[model samples]
Target chain A: MSASLPYAVHETAGHDNASMTTVGFWIYLMSDCLIFAVLFATFGVLVHSTAGGPDGKGLFELPFVLGETMLLLVSSFTFGAGMLSAQAGRKKQLLAWLAVTFVLGLAFIAMELHEFSTLIHEGAGPSKSAFLSSFFTLVGTHGLHVTCGLAWLIVMAHQVVRFGLDGIALRRLACLSLFWHFLDLIWICVFTFVYLREFL
Target chain B: MKAPLPHSGMEHAESHAHGNLKSYVVGFVLSLVLTIASFGTVMTDLVPHASRLATIVILCVVQLFVQLVYFLHMGTAKSQRQNTAIFACTSLLIVIVVAGSLWVMHNANVNMMPMSMSIQSALKHP
Candidate 1:
C-alpha cells in the first residue's frame, strides 16, 4: 500500500527538479529584493524633501494602513495553508486556500489604490514634490508586485485544477508560495520604515 | 499496507520538504504578534523616543525571519544550502549599495549650503 501511494513516487522523482526550481526561484527573488532596496534607499534620501508639500504625518492614515497590512499578512497565511494542502495532495483544500489568498490580495490592492487616489486628489501626486515622488515610487512598485503576484496566483490555481497536483504543478505552486511570503516580508519593512515610522 | 522503512533516507528527507500545518500556524502567530508590537510601539507613546525606532526595527527584522522560516520554509538543509548562500550574498550587496549611496548623498547634503536658495539668488543677480 505504501508503494501504491499516489503521490509518493512523484514526490520522490520530482525532488531533484523541484530543488533546482526552488533555487532558481530564490535567485530571482533576490534580484527582486535588490530592486526594492534601491527604491527604499531612494525613499530614504528624499523623505525629507517635501518641497512644502504634506509630509508622512499628514499623508499616512494609520488605521487604513493597518487594515491593508492585516489583509496581506492573512493572505500570506492562507497561501501557506494552500501550500500545505498541495503538499498533502488535497486539491480542493489547495484551491480553497488559494482562492482565499487571491481575494485577500485583491482587497489589499483595492485599499492601496484607494489610498493612492486619495493622495493624488489631495494635490499630493508624485510630481507635486520630491517626497511624494519617492513615496509613490516605493509604494507603487510594491503594489505593482502584488498585482503581478495575484495574476500568477490565478494562473497557478488554474494549472492546479488542470494538472491535479502533478509533480510539476505542485512544484510551481511551491514557487508561488515562496513569492507570496516574500512579498509579505517586504511589506513588513514597508510598514515599519514607511508608515509606522512616520508617527515616530 | 506495509510500513515505510524507518531508515529510508528519501522518505525521511521528503518529510522535511513541505512543511506541516503546525509550523505554518506557528509562523503566522509569530508574525502577527510582531506586527502588533510594531504598531503598538508607534501608535502609542509608550516606548521612549530613542528606543522606539530600535524597537520597531527589531520587530520588523524578527517578523521577516519568521516569514522566511515558517512560510517560505527556508533553511540550511542540504538542498537549501545553495539558495541560502545566494540570498546571503545578494543581501550583503543590497546593504552595501543602499547604505553606501545614502551615506554619500547625505554627506553631500550636509556639505552643500542651501543650494535652492542660492540658485534663486544666482538667477536674480545674473
Candidate 2:
C-alpha cells in the first residue's frame, strides 16, 4: 500500500506531504541507529584490548562525564521547548530556546574535545591500543553527530526567522527535534555503556 | 506577522511537531532521576557493587522508553505503529549483531589467548 494512504483521511493537516516525509525520515534514523549498533558492538569486542595502555577504569572520569551528560540532557529539553514554541507559533521563543540548546551542545563538544586532547597528551591516544581505538571511534562518532546537529539547529533557526512557523519550517524543525532527542538517547547509551561500566 | 501555523489546521500536526509541555517536563524529570540513580549507584558502592552494572543497564533501558514516549512520541498510536515496528526490528538486529560478535570473540579469546600466552612463557623460559 502507498504510504500516503494512511493519512488520506486527515488531509487538513497537509500531512499528505509531511507524513510520508516523517516516515521516510524515521527510516533514515533507524538506519543510522544500526550504524551505531555496529560501532557499539566493535567497542564491546575490543573493550579488553588495552595492549598495556590505559583502560576505561583508569581513564574515564565519571564526574566529568556526568557534567557532560547534564549539558546534553538539558539541551535536549531546551530543544523540546523550542519545538513547543514553534507549535504555538511563537517564533521568538523558539529561536531563544534553540540558541540556548546550541550553547549547551557547544559546551558539551568543547568538554569532549578537551577530554580527548588530555587523553592524547597522557599518551592514551586511540592508536595506543585497540580498546582506545574503539573508544575513540564510538564516542567520537557520537560527538560528530552532535556537531552536525548543532549546525542543523543554527540553520533551522535561520529558517524560522525568515519563514516563521510555515509548513516547511515546522516539518523541518520536527525532524530536527527527533534528531536532537535521538542524539541524547545515544548519549545515554554511551555514558552507561562506556563510562559507568568502567566502575565494574 | 504571527499566525498559528497556517496551512495545517490539525491537532495531530501540532502534537507531532511539538508534544505538550507536560510530557516534556515529565520526561525530563524522569530522565534526570534515572541518570542520577545510575551515577549514584556506581559512585556510592551501593547495590552490593557486583550488580551495579545490571542496575545501570536496567535504568538506562527505562530512560530510553521514557524519552521515546515523551520526547520522540513513539507509542502504540496509529501514527507511531510504523515507527515502533521499525525500532523493534532494529533492536533485534542490534542484539544479534552485538551479542553474536561478543560471543564469537569471547570464545576465540578463550581458545586462542592461552596458546599465545604459553608461547610467550616458553620463549621467556627457554
Candidate 3:
C-alpha cells in the first residue's frame, strides 16, 4: 500500500545523509555518556572507601592534575577550532588546528600515565585500596577515550586529505567533534568531584 | 508528511565557520588559572578544609561549564536539546547509583557491626 511514496519524502523520512550522521553521532554520545556515568558512579561510591589505605587527601596531587585538566580542556577547544576550519573549507587551518589538538591530547594522556606510574612507585597502586582502584578506573577510562580520539583524528585527517568536503567525511568529523567535546564534559566532573572535592 | 533530511551540506555552507579562537584562548588561560588556584588550595592548606574543598569544587564546576560553553559549544542550537537531555539523564542516573550505593554500603557496614570493623582493624594491624 505504501510503495509509491514521493522521492523527497522517502529521502527526508527514511535514511537521508545528514540526519543519519547527526542521529548516529547523538546515539554514540548517549552511549558514551552512559559509560562515563558508570565510571562516575563507581568513583563516587568508592571515593571514601579507602579500605584502610591513603585517601584522596593523601594521594591527589592537585598541581599535576590541574596541568592535565588544562591540557585536555585546551585540546577540546583546539578541536572545536579545527572543526570551525573544516566547516569553512580552510584545509591548511583545519590541519594545523587538528595537529595542535592532537598534540595537546597526547600530552594530557602522557601526564596522566606518568602520574599513575609515580603513584604506583610511591606504593599507591590501585591494589593498595578501593579508592585508588576507582580513581584509576575513572581517570584511566578517560585517558583511553582520548587515545581512541587521537586515533580517530588520524583517520579523519586521512579522509579529509583524500576526499575533501564530502558528506560521509563531514559526518565522521561531526561524530569526532561530539566525542571530543563529551570527553571534556566528563573531565569537568572528574576534576570537580574527584580531585577538587578533596579540599571541599 | 515525510520530513526531508536536513542536508548538512547546506547548513555547513551557510554556517559562519570562523571560530572564536580568541575566546577559546581566553577560556584556556582562565581554566589554567583556576586549575592553579585549586592546586594552591590543595598544597598550602591555606584555607580550612571545608572551605577549601568548597572553593575547589566550585572552581572546577565553573571551569568545566566554561569549557563546555566556550570550547565545546555544548547547548548550542545544533544539538543543544538532545545533548542537554542526554546529560541530564546520565547525571540523574549517576546520582542515584552513587548515592544509593554509598548509603546501602554504609548501612550494611553499620548493621554488620564487627565484621567490617574487624576487617578494618585486621588490615590496619597486618
Best by lDDT: 2
Which model is ahead, 1 or 3, in terms of TM-score?
A: 1
* Per-residue lDDT over A15-99 for candidate 1, one digit per residue giving the tens place of the 0 to 100 score: 5666778778988999999999999998888888887779999999998988999999999999888887777778899999999
lDDT for B30 (candidate 1)? 91
lDDT of 2 by residue, A53-95 (tens): 7899898899999999999999999999988887677889999
| Candidate 1 lDDT for residue B22 | 77
| A57-155 per-residue lDDT for model 3 (tens digits) | 777777777788778877877887887677666877888888898999889989988989988998999898888998999889888998999999899
Task: Please list the C-alpha lDDT of all candidates, in the order they appear.
Answer: 0.84, 0.85, 0.71
Cα deviation of A136, candidate 3, in Å: 1.5
TM-score of chain B of 2: 0.79
Question: In DockQ terms, which candidate is top?
Answer: 1
1 versus 3: better lDDT goes to: 1
Every model's DockQ, to 2 decimals?
Answer: 0.55, 0.54, 0.35
Q: What TM-score would every model get versus the actual structure?
A: 0.91, 0.90, 0.79
**Number of the top TM-score candidate:** 1
Give the least accurate 10-residue stretch of model 2 chain B, judged by summed lDDT.
B1-10
What does candidate 1 score on TM? 0.91
* lDDT score of residue B33 within candidate 2: 98
- In model 2, which regions exceed 4 Å deviation? A1-15, B1-17, B115-126
